[model samples]
Target: MTEYSRKQEALDYHAKPKPGKLAISVTKPFTTYGELSLAYTPGVAEPVKAIRDDPEDAYRYTSKGNLVAVISNGTAVLGLGDTGALASKPVMEGKAVLFKKFADVNVFDIEVDADDPADFIDTVERIAPTFGGINLEDIAAPHCFEIEAALIERLDIPVFHDDQHGTAIIVAAGLINALELQGKTLADARIVCMGAGAAGVASMKLLLEMGAQLDNVFMCDRRGVIHADRDDLSEHKAQFATKTDLRSVDDAIAQADVFIGLSGPDTVSKEQIATMPARPIVFALSNPTPEISPEDARSVRDDLIMATGRSDYPNQINNVLGFPYIFRGALDVRARRINMAMCVAAARAMGELARQPVPNSVLEAHEQREMAFGPDYIVPSPFDPRLIDYIPPAVARAAVDTGVARTEYPSHYPQPVVETDRD
Candidate 1:
């Protein structure tokens, strides 16, 4: 068998056979030729005319209100880094599926292979009219920052880079809940972030916005802690550099109230985790492999509240838990932009949801589940149905109240259809 056919056979047997990864189903069906003419050509002219008369009604008449485009140039495909467009299809498709599963939003994952940033931006901009919002996924940092900023400024619809903002929002939410559970405040906590990459920088910024003391934050890259003296730090890392003379991860780790790892595997030693202050909140958020395994972390520090990007852990600080609901809120309000205020609002909503009494349904999901909210249960499980019903509405209200929303929808959304028939 040919290699392509062999691969296709495996995918067909193990993946596509389970209902195919995606399907383009009709929204409003046109079974008859008369209905087809009405829906496609002749009668569709009336709605087209109305939309032309009032452009805002385009959202009302078309799928634009509920459709989002997951656009990426494949410069950074997850931790697999800089894998180019064709290889990034699976990840983008996964994101599209997540949007559909979580918020009932229809999504098209567009993987573009543009050699130039301008071409990529222009491409997205040209297609902006068809989507309610644009989700920039897995694009590389520095460039992603520039792309997101320019697009948000140019497009009327909300534009978000899920890697930077989404990861930051969810991490901030987890930190908020962890600190609250530990009876600590962000302003007083000594936060040491490992990895001054896009997500770490954004997380630090969110924490700062939420009252974290800048002086107390120690950002570390591969070389160790980021200081003004460090010549190797990225421009994003320089912004978070502290005045402290501490030059290594060990020093920062010894005094830290929180250890946030966005770096690679085995970067954090057990000795450093052990050196953290009593009840230290450690979010080791490296992907398939964390900076320190939860078992090893818990083995070293009895008082540590540990979380990772992995699902098997007690607290999985994944962006999937944040962006779908966040965009749902933004789209609901027809938000023009996603500001720091909206991000803070999302973090607060996530934290508050965790503070509430755990529902029996959620407790049942956990194997060692208990009806309590404490160290082990700092953040709400992603499966918590409250994410859809609560968090997004809070964000929408925040967007509207902050004057960022271009238009506002009704407060009440119909109960979502949890089950879908695979055609």
Candidate 2:
């Protein structure tokens, strides 16, 4: 279909049947006056008194344990840049849809119009008690870093910035499998990362935690390479700065084993891909268009394993593969925080899941006869049923092991599947 046609289709999809992508649904019966009284009124005072006596009773009587707030300020709405909070509702709603669809987690998409970081943080903090967790989305960097750190420090429930760690988790998982396929180890791999923004910095950090050497990773922003000698680097970017003579994306990728592009379209040339060592791993993850198209990169070097942020391509490094399941696990254990240990465990779980045999259901959904653990299938599909069973357990185990969990792993967990036939 043409771009215009696709745009109209999207508009129609959201506009039809009540002019939005989501709606509130009643979870309990209200057919009788007795049910109405129980739902809201004199009967509700019982739970109110119980929760008032013990604040922890809120989890038992209310939906707070399963509710996640997908909050955003519209500063960084996907690849669209700062489109304002009102304009970002569609994306936030989409995130809510994913959370509900993937992990059976309930979500309320909140768009805060405040520009000041302090105001945004305060607003979220005031509403923190209502949610089991917070999924911060579309907030720009620098401020995003500060906001997340402050909230994580203050809030008892998990507060995760999906733009940062969600992307990092999926990218790290895919890279693990890709590097293994290329017979390369993270410790020895020479990695060049384009775009030293939220996703780039976070991905590099997670990779380092997973055993990638700092000296071997080079980070580049728009000006050029992020080096130790640079005077204008942000603290987050400075953490990954290398004391090296390489000053450009071209220079940085030369002889490198991995090239991760979170930058704009066509920023990487075929010559740069050619300069990389044999069997390189390239994740040109810029959305809508990548730093280098898979076809363009493949024309230059057929030995490379390629991934992008687009679904049409194989090995798409989508964040849906991370955030929902991660939050599910966090909520299941009543985790105090989604710590580094839990994040690493989620990544490792994702990596291992990709290597297992593909179920017939998943193969049929993708219209494929086979999908072995190889260059094209480095990450599990979002629709993979096993993810619901696999990721949360690993993450919950990590949370318990790390002492971040408030309660023991429940025996009747993973919950019952309420809706099984989802495409």
Candidate 3:
């Protein structure tokens, strides 16, 4: 059976009842009236008074330290893009479960209906008191960019748009590992990015920060290659526009060492893949589809290192590789913000994880579970179980070092247990 069909079947059978995916149960008994008073009423006032006197101690007194809000307007629901808020609940809740399962962070999947960027920002800001951090999910590009910026500016807490930075970080990790395997360097390679949207634009920026030459990088959209001469370019695209004669996606692919396709399915031809430089790296990362099929790309260039966004692929460059651990670290540090250093560090961690000798479990996951790690295996298996232990500490340290953290977080071990609100 196809991997997707198998996965869907599992989901179908598993989701056969009400509250089938998640459950909430009391951890401590509240059977007595005195216990209820301590958990919910008069006795809870002790921690409240302490937190009021020293606000930073809230992380010590309540669940705020480990809770993240996976807030979305449902405007950009994966590849089904702009499906609206109500329709996006499943994906958001799924993200919450991943957050819980991966890092032990409590996630509240909040679906908001305010499509206006300003309204969404205002709503989130007003409700910001509730969450330790805000994870902006599946919002569309351009506007998503603006909303995240506004929220970060307005709130002291970390405000991250997972669609933009999470995908970028994971894709960057793949690129790092892929380039290493190809015996090439980011500084010397020419990159062609198809789809000048959220993930693509952020990926280009992050790559440039990692020493990719701006002039050698070409970013294109539906119209064509985004260049200084392009009449139609948003400020977002304008920043990365190049001064090049290559005005078409076809031209951009020609002579390029890397082709990153965040654009939708079947957009790139096999002929285009054949034209790329020797041993080219192609990340045709489209959801449920790709710009070019891996078989087709490999059919054209045997030396190519190919990846996609699907789990069926050997190297699935999914953001599922980044976000869970990222938030884990941020929350651990009581971070005020997630800055560039944290992202770069996370990417470096992921890239390093890819290069290690594939563990027996990973090899077994492939053989028993139909997944493996190799040339195409440029990342840990999504279910590898080490991401929580590895990636988060790296990011938390980066946040502390960059001075974006409010409470100093521990390294080498988790922080000591503290009394919760119910204590």
Candidate 4:
């Protein structure tokens, strides 16, 4: 479809399906006055008094164990920057839909109109009791860092900014497989990352946590390669700043083993891809259009293992692969917070899944290629049903092991499914 047609179709889809993308549904029986009284009046009051006596009973009596709040401000929404909180509702609702569909997690999409970081932080903190976990979305840079830090510190629930860590987790997963395919290692990989915004900064940090050396990862924003001498760097950007003389994206990518573009379309050229070392991995993950098209990159370096944010390409590093299952695990175990161990476990599980035999369901769903554990299939298809079993368990195990879990490992999970059906 043409761009205009696609836009019109999306608009019609959202509009025709009632008004918005979400609605409330009563979980308990309430068809008669007897049920109504039990649902709201006397029966509800009993649970309320019980919860008052023991706050932990809220999970037993309510949806608090399963509900996640997909909250956002309008800033840095997709490629459409700073559209305002009210305008961000649709995206937030769409996120809620994903959370529900992919992992069976309930969500209330909250759009906070506050522009000041402190105001937004205070607002979310005040409403923290209603959710099992908080999925922060679309709120922009330096402020997003502050907001997430404060919330994670103050709240006992898992507070995550999916824009930062979701992208990072999937990027980490895909990078793991790509590096393995290319006979490279994260420890030795010379990395160049463009876009020092949420995804860029977070991906670099996660990579560091997962064994990538600090000195080897060179990060570049629109202002060029972030180096120690750059006095204009924010705290997050400054964390990744290296003591290197490299000043441009071009300078950073010279002989680099990996290039990750969370920046805009065509930001890097074919010339830049050609300068990279043998069997280089490039994840050009800007939405709709990538920093350099995979076709352009491959035309120069035939050994390129390329991934984009588009499904039309090989190894699309989509955030859907990470967030749903991560949250599923966190909620299942009643984890206090989503820590680096849990994130790494999720990434490792994803990478391991990609190496396993493809199931027929996933093969039929992904028609992009004759699928296998190869360069084109670094990460398993997002539709792979095994993800629900594989990733969440890994995350839960990490949560329990790290002592953040309020409960034991979920009894229903790690229920391994035999995938005998494959092409």
Candidate 5:
């Protein structure tokens, strides 16, 4: 589609049929005056009183068990920088759509206008009672890191920054499969990451936690490689800073086994990609336009396995594959937090799922009759029905095993038929 047509279609999509992508619906009977009494006045008061007796009862009587808040300050929208909170509502609403459609999780898209991280944290904590979990969206780095940490400490519910950990989880999943295909492992690979922002920092951290050696990973930002010699590094960047002589992204990519780009468009040249050794794994995750286009990257070496954030390409490292299912498991078990165990479990599950035979539904969705766990098919498709049954149980089991769960393992996890008030 042409750029103008695409813009018009997007605008019309949000403007027509409804003013936005979401609406509130009553999930219980309310047509009759008798039902109204139960929904609002005397009968509602019974559940309210029960909740007052024990705060845990709120999940029993309310939508809090399956409801998530998609919160954003809009400082760093994907492909669009600092669009502001109000401008970010459409994106958050889009996130809500994904949450509901993919995992059947109800969502409230909240756009906070607070500039201060503490203020944003306070606002979220005050409204924390309404949600089973919080999915922070599009907030810029450093602050995104701070807000997530603060809220995770203060709130009992699961809090996740999708741009950070969600992206990272999916990256880990694809990378695991990619490594298997390339005969490489995270522990020994020379990995060059061309970004020091939220996704870059979080991806590196998760990989480190998953057994990637700190010295084997090289991180670069606008000023070049994050090194111990750089005095201007933030704490997050400092965590990856090394004493290497490699000063640029290009320098880091040479002889590296993996090149992961969470940076800007075309930041790494074809010449730079050509410098990598045989059987390199490349994830050019910069959206809309990658650091190096697959065509250009592939032209350099036939042994390269590539992934991108765009769905147009094969092996897309999509957050949609991670967040919904992760939260589904968390909500099912009433988990207090989405910890490292849960994330690693989800990643491992996703990696393993791709190796299984592709379901017909997944093949049909992608206009394919068959797909194997190879270079292009390293991660499970977002539309794969097995995702509902596969990843969430792994996450829920991990949550239970790690002692973060408030409830026992649910016996009724299915592609469930949710009870709605529709008559």
Candidate 6:
């Protein structure tokens, strides 16, 4: 199908089935008078009073424990750039759908038209009582960092910017498996990151937490390398700034063990890929189109492992693999925040899941005959049912271990479901 045809189909899918992609569904029946009374008025007031007396009781009596608020200011809707809040509704709703389908978590997509970071943070903090967790989406960098940090400090519930941590977690997981496949270690890998925005910065930080050395990592923004010499750097970007002589993507990619591209399409050339070290790993994760196409990268060196944001390619490093499961675990444990421990734990769980035997169901979903812990299969399929069972437990345990959990870990996690799983 042509691009125009696909675009039309997407519009039809969203428009034809009602005006939007999501709607509210009442969990309790309210057919009879007694049922209606219990759902509202007198019975509801009892729980309200109980929660007033002990705020923790709100989780027991209300949907707050299972509810996640997907809030976005829409300053940066994916690669679209500053599309504004109303324009980002569909993407937020799509995120809501993923939360429900992947982890059985409930999401209310909230789009706030606040341009100021302070206003966005305040708006989210005011509604903190209504949600178990907040998934911050599509707010641009520098401000996004400020918004998330301020909210995390102010709110007791978990506030995670999926654009930063979600992308980071999945990238770390896939990079772990890819490094293993190439017989390389994170500590030793000479890394080149081609974007200094949210995902690029966060992924590098997470890697540092996971044992990647600071000096081994080189970050690049549009203004070439993010080195110490650059004066016009945001505080977030400054964290990754190295005192390097390397000034260009070409200079950084030379002899690098890993090349991570979170930048625009076709920014990397086949010549750059050829300059990388033997058995290198490249994650060209720019959406729709990657910094370097998989074919172009592979044509230069067959020994290299490649991953992209596009699902049509092998070893796609998609954020869907992280956010749903991460939030599921955070909500399950009543985590005060999504700490680095939780993020690392989730990444470790995903990396370990990749090494396990591929279920026949997964192979069939991808229309493949077989799959294993190889170059092409470094990340678990998003449809893998085991993710619900595997990720949340690890994350919850990490939360408990890190002393961020408000409640004890549940004995019965990921309760069995009847629905058939698909990728």
* Residue 301 displacement (Å), model 6: 0.6
lDDT at residue 22 of model 2 (Cα atoms): 79
RMSD of each: 5.8, 4.2, 5.7, 3.2, 5.2, 3.9
Q: Is candidate 2 or candidate 4 better by lDDT?
A: 2
Model 1 lDDT-worst window of ten: 414-423
- Against the correct fold, how does model 2 do in TM-score? 0.96
Q: Write the per-residue lDDT of candidate 1 for residues 139-181, one digit (tens) a residue.
A: 8777887788889889999898888889898888788778877
> What tens-digit string does per-residue lDDT give for candidate 3 at 1-423?
999999998788557776435666566778999899988889999999999899887888788888889999999898887999988888888888888887887888889998999999999999888889999998987899899999999998898888889989998888877887788888888999998998888899998887789998999898888999887888999998889888888889997999999989999999999989888999999888899999999888999998998888778887778888998888877898999888887887777776556566766766754434457688777777666766887788888889998767675645322212110
Q: Which consecutive 10 residues in model 6 have the weakest lDDT in total?
A: 414-423
The positional error of residue 397 in candidate 6, measured at the CA in angstroms, is 0.2
Model 4 regions more than 4 Å off: 415-423
Prediction-by-prediction clash tally:
0, 0, 1, 0, 0, 0
Q: lDDT by residue for model 6 over 310-367, one digit each (tens)?
A: 9899998988899999999999989999999899889888888888899998988999
The digit string of per-residue lDDT tens for model 4 on 5-82 reads: 999999998999598888889888879999989988777899999999999998999999999999998998989999
Over the full model, what C-alpha lDDT does candidate 4 score relative to the true structure?
A: 0.90
Backbone clash total for model 1 is 0
Task: Report lDDT (CA) for all predictions.
Answer: 0.83, 0.90, 0.84, 0.90, 0.90, 0.90
* Ten contiguous residues minimizing lDDT sum, candidate 5: 414-423
Itemize residue pairs with steric clashes in candidate 6.
none
By TM-score, the better pick of 3 and 6 is 6
Can you list the residue pairs that collide in candidate 4? none
TM-score for candidate 6, residues paired by index: 0.96
